[model samples]
Target: MFRFLRGLVLPEAACEEANSSSRYENLFKKLDLNEDGRVDIAELHAGLKALGIPLGKDAEEKIFKTGDSNKDGQLDFKEFMQYLKDHEKKMKLAFRSLDKNNDGKIEASEIVQSLKILGINISEQQAEKILKSIDADGTMTVDWNEWRDHFLFNPATDIEEIIRYWKHSTVLDIGDSLTIPDEFTEEEKKSGQWWRQLLSGGVAGAVSRTGTAPLDRLKVMMQVHGSKSNKMNISSGLKQMVKEGGVRSLWRGNGVNVIKIAPETAIKFWAYEQYKKIFANEDGKIGTVERFVSGSLAGATAQTSIYPMEVLKTRLAVGKTGQYSGMFDCAKKIFKREGLKAFYKGYVPNILGIIPYAGIDLAVYEALKTAWLDHYASDSANPGVFVLLGCGTVSSTCGQLASYPLALIRTRMQAQALLEGAPQLNMVGLFQRIIANEGILGLYRGIGPNFMKVLPAVSISYVVYEKMKQNLGIA
Candidate 1:
């Protein structure tokens, strides 16, 4: 009997279209209570009520007035299906129009255009308002899935209703929505600002120095003697240094790195923010391409100012023994030994690498943060510690992948001082040596350590900086 019943109920051909049709038919039958093949007022009210919606007499009257096309005080299944199909068609058309690139994705630019066409003038604030409403993944893009789920799959058929629903959605009300406390006084704000600046400086410097240290050591080892064996590892390299020069050798040129970090990060962050603000909507949100451009420009600006210090740091880090005493002595010796141009020996590759590295890093971080929040914390107002950590990891990975080759070249150029009477290696010489001697793989020798250094260093830096800013109420 059960088998017979199942056979009777289930269709033989179970294709997607068949399943969808079955679902629609089931829905129709469920709504058409009393086996009447039609939905009466009582049946509609009961259905709405079952769904936990209050459909009082007044609400029923309004629904009947709009949905009852035949003026029969009832809804036949055909009429109801027609109404739903028409609304779905309209929504699909609207979605297609908004996805101007026809890439099946609605970008922020498309949203801006769509809003304009809908007769809504979107100011920067208004754009942010709308963007925050629809950007489910926080990637700042409004792909079809996000648009459909967040905007279209609702009983609110009109644009106004959709907007209203979005305005109240949990996604839009996250971290930035809460009201400031009355006890947050002016003195507290000023003190917080002071501490924030200090913290930004300290954290930025520490992260920069730490990230460069491993790379500095690896570059020196490779330049003085190529990474032919397992001795290229950090532990092995340290052991070699201890045997030759002593414990102090490991910290070679650390002073230059520490000193350079402050200016490098200060300039980089400041420039990044400025460029982001310029290209972004006035409310300080940007699209993916805009974010990339802004970050690249910022990196270029920062690297230009500090590339000389980078060269000096690398030179001091590498070598046999006693090439220079410390950061200051290194600078003096480089000036005396090689011309001032020696300080920028590998400027080309370094500058080029900075463009992709910074842009990809920042963009990936923001994109990952949005993705994690959307997927894991969609109902919450703030991302937890894990989300921030994941974002940092993603950002570091993208940056390192894009810039590893250039990093190798820069290291080689800087460590060229180890070679007896070797002239300053330019971009060409560095590339040739790396290719001819070690094959292509030589260029990515310390990638594992590079990623390890970057991931934690960048992750901690950003997480700390963001938390500090949030705690201090400095958006």
Candidate 2:
């Protein structure tokens, strides 16, 4: 009698298992959008769109070409899985590399060494100061678990959450709650709205450029020469630069950077708005995944158009003493030397980085603003300075961390053109060089000052922009 009942249950169990397996299998199959047993460019695009994951044209091409095995131009289930696995592996490797001693903890020396490798010119004294600020325990070394749990993965202080909050609050009209009136004439559309975007973007561009120019110059300098060299510290570096080339040297790439700013910011904001509108409902609410998808897509789109200028800007910023007199000269020189495509030398990592950086940065900014307005601010129209500062700090920190690796790659590629007799610095060459010279830790240089810089800059920019927009009633 027992055997008979067991037999019946066994068949039912097998059937249930089969059903569950089939469901997962189907889901994996969907990831292969082209149905070619792999996910190709079209398939990846369709699948990401379906899943609300945004992939720019460049990213799609890179992923398809690399992720697909056998050059079949598609990503089979195995290939897709492998790509995900590889990402996880890299993350794990990053964590491991950060944990210098096999003792599973990160020491001050380890962190300092990591920065040194990435071309950041931080003294051991500075690293010690940073560690003391973050480390509450008297422990001289931070453990891997502690580094991850407390520093990298702390939920209360997660950079991703902070960034999302900031983005949510900063946008003029998120979701469908805000609407532009259709009664506006076409001329008004071009002259009024377009002009506002352009002007605002120009302001943003100018502010961002001015705020970052010095630091950008310093960062490129450190990357070109080893960080241990004399011109690594900010004040010392600035002094040396001025001494060598005069005060004007500090603003080496300002011309191009300033010009690029208006269109870059305008396009980025516009793309972000358009992308958000496409995916979100009228109420301005979207699921978490959808927000990520939209933000990433928007970032990729914006970066693609603006990237050439960025390359030129970087080249101008780090070239040998006086490579080109001005932005136009630099552009002409690059065109003549490397052809039109040279302007987009580091296009790959840049696009990939922008997706996450913009998406997370915007999302966090909005979220932080919303939180501040709801809990802390007496009025949404005029949140306190502290509230804005806090929001900016959180949002920028998250955006930088997520995009650090790509930033490293971009800086390397941009500086490559200026390095005499240096081998071409593709992504692979950059990574290998970093690994060989500095070990795995070479990829996160300048992250400390970068974090410090981004927080204040973004925070101030957002607060000012928001106040200006509100005053103008341009939302």
Best by TM-score: 1
Per-residue CA lDDT of model 1 for 1-475, tens digit only, reads 2122123332334223436456446556756768888888888778655544443654465456556899998888776766655655666666786678898776657665665443233344444445565665567666544554343224444443333211111110000001110111223345565446445545554555554565556545654455665446766766787788886676676677667655765576567667866886764445556655765676678778988888877777775577666677878888888878888877788777866665565557656644543455433323544555565456656766787788778777766765778666678887787788788887787665555555445554665565555555542
- All models: lDDT? 0.57, 0.56
RMSD each, Å: 16.7, 23.1
TM-scores vs. true structure, each candidate: 0.54, 0.53
Model 1's alpha-carbon lDDT is 0.57
**In model 2, which range of ten residues has the least summed lDDT?**
173-182
Candidate 1's C-alpha runs over 4 A off are 1-198, 207-216, 229-231, 269-288, 366-374, 421-425, 455-475
lDDT of 1 at 310: 81
- Model 1 residue 279 CA deviation (Å) reads 4.7
TM-score of 1: 0.54
